[model samples]
Target chain A: MTEEIIIAGFGGQGVLSMGKILAYSGIMQDEEVSWMPSYGPEMRGGTANVMVILSSERISSPYLKVFDTAIILNQQSLDKFQDSVKPGGVLLYDPNGITIHPTRTDIEIFQIEGNKLAVDMGNAKISNMIVLGAFLKIKPIVKLDNVIAGLKKSLPDRYHHLIPLNREAITKGMNNLKPFLVAEMILK
Target chain B: MAELKLMKGNEALAEATIRAGADAYFGYPITPQTEVIEYLMEQQPEKRTGMIVLQAESELAAINMVYGAASTGKKVMTSSSSPGISLKQEGISYMAGAELPGVIVNVVRGGPGLGTIQPSQADYFQSVKGGGHGDYKLYVLAPASVQEMSDFVEDAFDIAFKYRAPVLILSDGIIGQMMEKVYLKDQKPRMTNDEIIEKYGNWATTGKKGRERNIITSLDLQSEKMEKRVHRLMKKYKQMEAEDLRFEKIACDDADYLIVAYGSSARISQKAVELARKKGIKVGLLRPITLFPFPKKALFDLANQVKGILSVELNAGQMVEDVRLSVEHKVPVEHFGRTGGIIHTPEEILEALEQKIINNGSIRHHKTRESSIL
Candidate 1:
C-alpha cells in the first residue's frame, strides 16, 4: 500500500512537523517513508509545503507531482493544491480563515475548524494535531498508538508533559470532523 | 543490527561523520547544508567521541583546516553548498596536489552565482570534470537517498585514505533537506597517533620520528620533478578508476531504452522508469554511484542493447555530455532536465523520453537513430 500526501500552510502552523510526525508514525509501523519540504525564501512569512509518502515498499521519489491526499491549512494552500489531489482521493483542510473553498467534485473533501477548536482548548499550538486526528479518522492508515509513539519520539523530553493535551486535541478533532457540502461546493 | 532512526539527510551525514570516527569537522554554515554543522554542534561529538567540530569563519578557512588536519593522517571532513564549495576549490586543488586524504561535501544548490537555495545538480561539470585549477579529480560519490547520505561517509573516508586522495560527497539540497529512515552503524573509535604513524607514516607528517623529515608540499620549482609528481597523481586516479567504480542497474536486461542519472535525479528517474514500464515501454535506469570513476563501461554495454538514452539531471544538461562520450555517440543520448532549482517530474521525464528519444530524431546523430528506429 502507498499513500502520497502533501501538507501545506504557513510556516509557523507546524506543516513540516505534522509531516515529520506522519513519517515517524510510518516508521513505527515498519513502513518506508519520505518527507521532502519546500525550503528557502518561500518559507519565511510565505507558503510552506512538504511532500510526504508512506509505502509498504521502498519509496521511489520523495518529490511528487500529485498527491493521494492534500492537507491544507490556509486559503493559499487550498488555492494552490486543490487541483493537485488525485481523483477519488482525499482533501482535508482547516477552514479557520479560508476565504475560498475547494471545488473538486472527484475527491472527498473534509473541513475542520482547527484554529477555533485549539482556541477553545486553551492551546492554539495543538491545531495541527487536531487536523491530523481528523485525517486519521477518515483514513485510519496509521494506528493511534503508533501516532502517540511517533509524537513521543519527535518531541523533546522537556515537552513530554504536553502529550496528553495533544492527544485530547486529536480526539476532539476526530470527533468534530465535518464533510464539506458537495452541493455548496458546486454552487461556489 | 543497526540503529534505525528517521533523520534529515544532512543530519544523517553529520551523525555518520561522528560515528565514522572522524577526527574533526570544519565547515562554514550555508543554506541547505547548515543543518550538517547545526547537528554536529548540538550533538557535541567532542564530548562523545573526542572529535572536534568547529565553525570556521569562511569556506576557505574551513577547507584549509581540513587540508591541515588531513596532513596529519587524521580523518577529517567539511561540508558546504554550491557557492561555498566554489570558494573552497583552490583549497581542494591544493589538497589534491599535496595528496591529502579528506572528505568534502557539497550539498549543491541551484547556481552559476548564488542562483537559489533550492536543490540542484548543476555542479555536475564542476565536480566530475575538475572544478579547481588543476588536472586533479576528486573521487566524487553521488548519494541518492538519506541512507546513502549517511552510509557514504564511511565509504568515502575509506576510499580517501586508501588512495590518499580527496573524496567528495556530491549531494543536492533535496537529499540534504529530506527526511527518511536510515540505519546508522555503531560508533567506531578514532585512531590513535601510534596507529596513524603505523598506517600513513611514509607520507603523512605524523611527527617525523625515526626517519627522514617528512615534508608535505604540492610545490616543485623544477619542471621535471613537477611532471613526475603529476604522473604519480595520474596513476592514483587510474587505480581508482580501475578498482573503485560503482553503479546500479535496474530493469536493463530487457530494456529498449535507458535513462542515465545520478543522485536525486536517479531517484526521480527510477519512478519514471516504473511509469514507462506500466505503459508497456521497455525502459531502464543506470545510476552512477561514483561520478568521477563513472560507470562508462556499463553505459557502453547498455548502449549496445538500448535504442536510446535520456540523461536526466537537475541542470540544463551537463552530464549528458559525459553520457554521449561514454557510449561514443553510438546511441541517441538526449538530456531532459529543469534548471534553477526546479525538479523534473517523472511524468515529464517519460514524456521527454518519448518525445526526444523516440519521436524526435532530427536533433543530433540522426544516422544513429535511423538504424535503431526499427
Candidate 2:
C-alpha cells in the first residue's frame, strides 16, 4: 500500500527531521520513499512542512494534494493541514502546542501531550521521538527494531551516547499511547 | 568496478568529478547544489588526494575561476542554481568565445527572481540556447538520476576537452536532492597539468616567459576575421552534432505515440508510458541526455514511425519547439506541462495523452497558446 504523510510545524519543532526519519525508515524497509520539504521562505522561523510518500511501487509525483496522514506539531500546522487530510484518514497533533480541536468529523484525530511526555522522559527535544513512537503504533509498516537501527545509522557517531535516552523516550511515548490503541481496536 | 552505494545527485556529481580527474573545483554554494561543495570540503580532496577545491564568493567569480583554470589546460568545474547560473552567463560566454574547455553544473530551482527553492526545469531555453550573450553553444547534458549524475560529469568533461568547448550539466532540484544507488568508476580518468602543458604549452600563458607572447582573447575587430571565427565555431558545433549526440529510447520502435522528455520530467513520462500501455495504447518515451545536439536525427526517425509526439516538460513549452523543429512539422507534436514550481504528474500526462492521442481531440490547444504567447 502507498501511504502519503505530511509533517508540519515551526522550523525548530523538528518537523523536517521527523519527516527524514520516516523516509529513512521507509528506505530501510526497501520501500520507495520521497521526502519533499517546503523550501519557501516560510522555512525561516515560520511554519516548516515536509511531504513524504512511501510506496511499494514507484512514486510518481512527490507533491501531495491529499494526504493519508498528517502529523501536526502546532496549532498552525493543525489549521493548515486539517482540511487536506483524506476522509477516514488519521491526524496526530501535539496537545501541548495545538489547543483548537479539529472541526472535521470525517477523519480520526489523535492528540498527544508530546512535550510533557518527552519532559518526563528527561528531554524536551525528544518530543519528535514521542510523535514517531505514536506514528509507529498507528502505522506499523516498520518494526521498532528497524527504527532503532535506522536511528543508530542516521545519528552522528559523537552523539552515540544519547541512543539509550532516545530509545527510552520512544518507549515512554509508546507506553502513553495505549489508550488510543485500545480505542482504535474497539472501533475496528 | 567499484561497489554501488546510495547517493544524492549533488554528492554523486562531486564524486564523479574526482573520478574524472578534475584538477580543480571552483564553485559557490546554492540550494539543491550545496551538497556538492559540502562533499568536496568535508572529503578534503586536497589533503587526502591531490585535487583542488575552492569555495568562491559568487557564481560569476566561480565561473571566471573556471575560465582561468581551464585556460591552463586543467579540467575544472563549477556549480550553481538558476539565479546564480544567470549571473555566470557572462563568464560562460567568455569561455565559449575563447574556446576553453570546462564543466558547469546548474542545479535548477524555480525562478525568474528568488522565486522558490523547489525543483523546476524552467531554465530549458536559457541552457539550450546559450544562457550567455553573443552566438555560442554549450555541450549541455541533462541527467535524470544519481547514476547519470555521476556518469555524465565524466562524459561532459570528455566532450569539452575533445571539442575545446564549455560543457553544462543541466539538472533540477529533485534530481539533486533525491537519493539513489550509483556505481562509481573504478579508476579515475587521468589528466595531468604537466601533460597538458607538454601538449598545449605553446599557447598557454605560463607567465609569458621563455616563449613567444601568446594572446588569449575573443576579440576580432576585422569583420572578415570575426565572420571566419564564427564559422569555425559553427563547424565545431556541426562536428559535435554529427558525433556527440546521445539519448535513451524506451519502447519507441513500434509505438503509435512518442513522448519526448528529459531530466526529471522523463522519469514521470516513463510512468505515463506504463499507464498508457496497461490501457492498451502503444506509447513510448525518447529521453535526450544531450540538449544541445537535440538528438534531431533519432527523433526525426521516430517521427516517421509514430503517429504523434508529446513533448513533456516542467516549464511552459521550451522543448516542444525543438521537437517540432526536429520533426519538421511532419506529425502532430503536442505539449503538456506545469510551470511556476509545480511538477507534472504521470496521471496528468496520461490524461493529456489519452485525450489527444486516444480520443483524438484538440491536441493543438497548447501549441496555439505557446505560439500566441511567444
Candidate 3:
C-alpha cells in the first residue's frame, strides 16, 4: 500500500516534524518513505508544508500533485489543499485556527480538535501530534506503538522528556476526530 | 555493515562524506543546500574520523580551500547550490586544469542570477556543458534518491582520484531537501600522510621528500605544451564517456515513445511514464544517472526504436539539446519543462507527451515549450 500525504500549516506548528515522524514510523514497519518539505524563507512563517509518501513498494516522485490524505492545520492550508485531495481520499485537519471549512463532498473530511487537546495536555507543542493521531485513526498507516516509538526516535535526546505527553496528545486527538458526513453534505 | 536509516538527501550526503573518508569539506552556506554543511558541523567528523569541516566565508574561498586541500592528495569536497556553484566554477576549472581530485556537490536551485532557493535542473548546461572556463568536463553524477545522494559521495571520490580529475554530484534542491530511507556505507578511514605519498607522491605536495620539488601549475606559455594538456583532459573525458557512462532504462523494452530526464525530473517522468502507459501510450523512461558522461550512445540506440523522444526537465530545454544531438535528428525530439523553480506534475508531463510527442509523431522535427501553466 502507498499513501501520499501533505501536512501543511504555519512554520512553527511542527508540520514538517509531524511528516518526518510519520515517515520514520513507516520505516520502522520496513516500508519505503520519503518526506519532502517546503523550504526556504517562506518556511519561516508563511504557511510551511511537507509531502510524505509511505509505500510498501518503491516511491517514485517526491513531488506529488494530488494527495491521498491532506492534513491541513490552518485556514490557509485547508483553502490551498481542500480541492487537491484525491477522490475517495481522506482530508484530516485541525480545527484550531480554521475559519472556512472544507467544501469537497467526494472526500472524507475529518477534523481533530488539536488546539483544545493540546491545551488539555498542558503542552501547546503537541498539537501536531494530535493531528497525526487523527490521521493514524483513519488510515492506521502505521501502528500506534510504532508511532510512539517513531515520535521518540525523531526527537533529539534533549526533547525526550516530551514524548509521553505527545503520545497522550495523539491518543486524545484520535478520539476527538469529527467526521464530516453526508448530513453535512446535504446541508451544504 | 551499513544500516538503513531515514535521512534527508543533504544530511545523507554529509554522512556519506564522513564515511567515504573525505579529508576535508570546505563549503559556504546556501539555501536548500545548507543542510550539508550543517550536518557536517553537527556530526563533527574531525572528532570521529579526523575529517575536516570548514565553513568558508564565501563560495570562492570555499572552492579554493578545497583546491588547497586536494593538492595534498586527500579526499576533499565542497557543496553549494546553483548561484554559489557559479562562483566556484573558476576554482573547479583550476582543479580540472591542475588535475586535482575533489568532489563538488551542486544541490541546484533555480538559476540565471540570484534565483529562488527552490529545486530546479536549470544548471544542466552549466554543469554538463562546462560552466567553468577552458575546454574541460566534470564527471557529473545526478542522484535521484537520498540513498544515491549518500552513495554517490563515495563513487565521486573514487572516480575523481582514479582519473585525477574532479567529479560533481549534480543534484537539485528537490533531492537535497527531501528525506528518504538510505542504506549508508561503512565508514572508511581517511588516508594517512604516508598512504597519500604512496598513492600520489608523484604529483602531490607531500613536502617534496627525497626528490626535487614537483611544481603544480595550470599555465604553459607554449601553445604546444598547453595543447597537449588540453588533449590529455579531453582523452580522460573520452575514457570516462566510454567506460563510466551510466543510465537507467525504465520499462524501455517494447516501448514506442521514450521520455529522457534526470534527477527529480527523471523521478517525476517515471510516474508520467506509468500514467501514459495506462492510457494506451507505449512510453518508457530513460534516466541519465551520469549527466556529463551522458549516455549518448544509449540515447542514439533507443532513438532508433522509439517513435518519438521527449526530454523532460525543470529548465527550458537544456538537456533537450543534448538529446537532439544524440539521435542526430533521426526521431522527433521534443522538450517539456518548467523553469524558475517550478516543478511539473506527472499529469502535465503525460499530457505533453501525448499532445506534443506521441500523438503528433508526424512532425518529424524538434519542438519545445516553456512551461507557463501550473
Q: Which candidate gets the maximum TM-score versus the true structure?
A: 1
lDDT of each: 0.93, 0.83, 0.89
Rate residue A10 of model 3 by lDDT.
90
Task: Summarize candidate 1's per-residue lDDT along A118-187 as a digit string, tens digits.
Answer: 9999989999999999999998889989999999999999999999998898899899999997788676
Candidate 1: misplaced stretches above 4 Å?
B363-374
In angstroms, the error of model 1 at A40 is: 1.7
TM-score of chain B of each: 0.97, 0.93, 0.96
Record all residue pairs in model 2 with backbone atoms less than 3 Å apart, i.e. clashing.
none
Score chain A of each prediction against the true chain A by TM-score and list the results: 0.97, 0.90, 0.94
| Span of 10 residues, lowest total lDDT, candidate 1 chain A | A179-188
Sort the candidates on DockQ, descending order.
Answer: 1, 3, 2
Candidate 3: list runs displaced more than 4 Å. A182-188, B364-374
Interface RMSD score of candidate 3: 0.8
For candidate 1, give the docking quality class from DockQ.
Answer: high
Predicted candidate 3 versus true structure: per-residue lDDT over B1-374, tens digit per residue: 77888898999999999999888999999988999999999999999999999999999999999888888788999999998999999999999998999999999998789989888999989988888999899999999999999989999998998799999999998999999999998989899878876775567887877978876678888999999999999999999988898899999998999999999999999989888888888898999999989888899999878888999999988999999999987788889999888889998999898888877836543333212221
Q: Return the top candidate by lDDT.
A: 1
Ranking by TM-score: 1, 3, 2
